[model samples]
Target: MTLGLIGRNAGRLLVPLIFIFGFYIVVHGHITPGGGFQGGAVIATGVALLLVSYYYRDCLERFIPITNFKLVESAGLMLYICTALAGIVVGSGLLFNWLNASGGLFGHPVAYGVNPGDLFTAGTIPILNFAIGIEVFGALSVVTLIMFAGLQEKTQQEEDAEAAESAAPLVSKRKKGKGGRK
Candidate 1:
């Protein structure tokens, strides 16, 4: 069974809201509490809501294509690796904040003492968060799609067995009496 009309409508409305909120968390994560992992989980939860509200076939066709998710996953992972590798190529340590205090682009100088937070001041953190968020979201969505699709597909043999079982009549037989007569 699937969601009723209200549930389906709610899911449709809420999914976008969930996505925006998730992105917000990811972008602001360098200064705030929520980061890539948390935001990714939130987005995945929205996808799960979609899965529950609709049939698997429709979800896969109308929205959650596995290949698209896989592509996104790969892209995120590649971006993360490239960004990390950039530090070493620039003669800095791995995962270094090479852009900090350089005064261009993501190289904004961060105040040493207490001050208001600047989004770009965190440098590679935001980029890392973006990459991780994308990877997590894609991986999770793909996993959900695969699981639901597998459950929904019906094999010919399985269908036949179900049909035969349902078509068969119910019969009861009593054991013979002690004397071999009833």
Candidate 2:
């Protein structure tokens, strides 16, 4: 069963805000209290809210499908691993902070203390955060969608079984038949 019209409308209205908040958390991980993982969880929570507000089949058709989610999850994991491997290529060890102080993209050095945070600093932290965020979002969203669909299928099967039982004819237990065991 799905939520009423008001709930659905509310969920639809909140989706963009939820996504923006999640992205904000991810992008500001280095300067704030949240990170990629937390941001992704927030995004997944939004997806869960959508699932609750609509029917599973409708969600599958209208929003992110399970297949697409799986693909995105796989791509995110690959990208994260590739980002880590980049450190090895640069001779800085695996996942080493190579981009710091390099004056390149995301390579600015941080000042000594009590300074304003630079968005382009922190080396590979931002990249890794993005990768992890996408991975977590896709994984959790897909899992929630699949579980909802599974439960719906189970309920439908049970209902079908009940209907079948109700439609079947009842036979008397005391029928005298020639094939009866004596």
Candidate 3:
């Protein structure tokens, strides 16, 4: 995802749109071919695009808190667990499709319809998709951050080494030029 070509420039402009599309894919996953893992990876590419651009990359890290990533990850896990437990409490097997019955927001006995394999259909699938999405995004962001930090550290070390080498010979020459006159 290095930024230097026409394609990369074009991608920078398209990244936000891609992210939106990815979310749509995840949300509609029950009806469609795509799911949380695939959509989350696509969304991560949007962040990779920004990182590669080199413009405002440092500022991005400052504005996005790492804590937010951790919180999202934790919340996703908890939601998945609680949802599975709800199935058990209702006498449905763990992760059983209790929400599969149609027409009621709460289990209040509205008209029952068969699950349509669509987004409007209720079940554990959508909730699980959301959980995977959050986990994947958080993990990818942390990995990218660590990689950039390592690169920056290597760059700084090289610069410091060069500066020390340049200064050393100059100091030695000055001493030789001044004392040799005696």
Q: Pick the candidate with the highest lDDT.
A: 2
Ranking, TM-score, top scorer first: 2, 1, 3
- Model 3: per-residue Cα lDDT over 1-182, one tens digit each: 24557756787679889899889977887677888888877887787677666433344556775667677767767887888889899755788878665455422332345644445555567778877877777777667766765565323245445656666666677665443222
Instruction: Candidate 2: list runs displaced more than 4 Å.
Output: 153-182
**Quick one: how many clashes does candidate 2 have?**
0
The lDDT values for all models are 0.79, 0.82, 0.67
- Candidate 1: where is the Cα deviation over 4 Å? 153-182
* Model 3 lDDT-worst window of ten: 102-111
lDDT of 2 by residue, 57-92 (tens): 644445767899999899889999998999999955
Clashing pairs in 2: none
Superposition error at 118 for model 1 (Å): 1.5
Off by over 4 Å in 3: 1-12, 55-57, 105-117, 153-182
Error of 3 at 41 (Å): 0.9
- By TM-score, the better pick of 1 and 2 is 2
Cα misplacement distance, residue 138 of candidate 3 (Å): 1.4
- List TM-scores for all candidates, in order: 0.78, 0.80, 0.68
lDDT score, candidate 3: 0.67
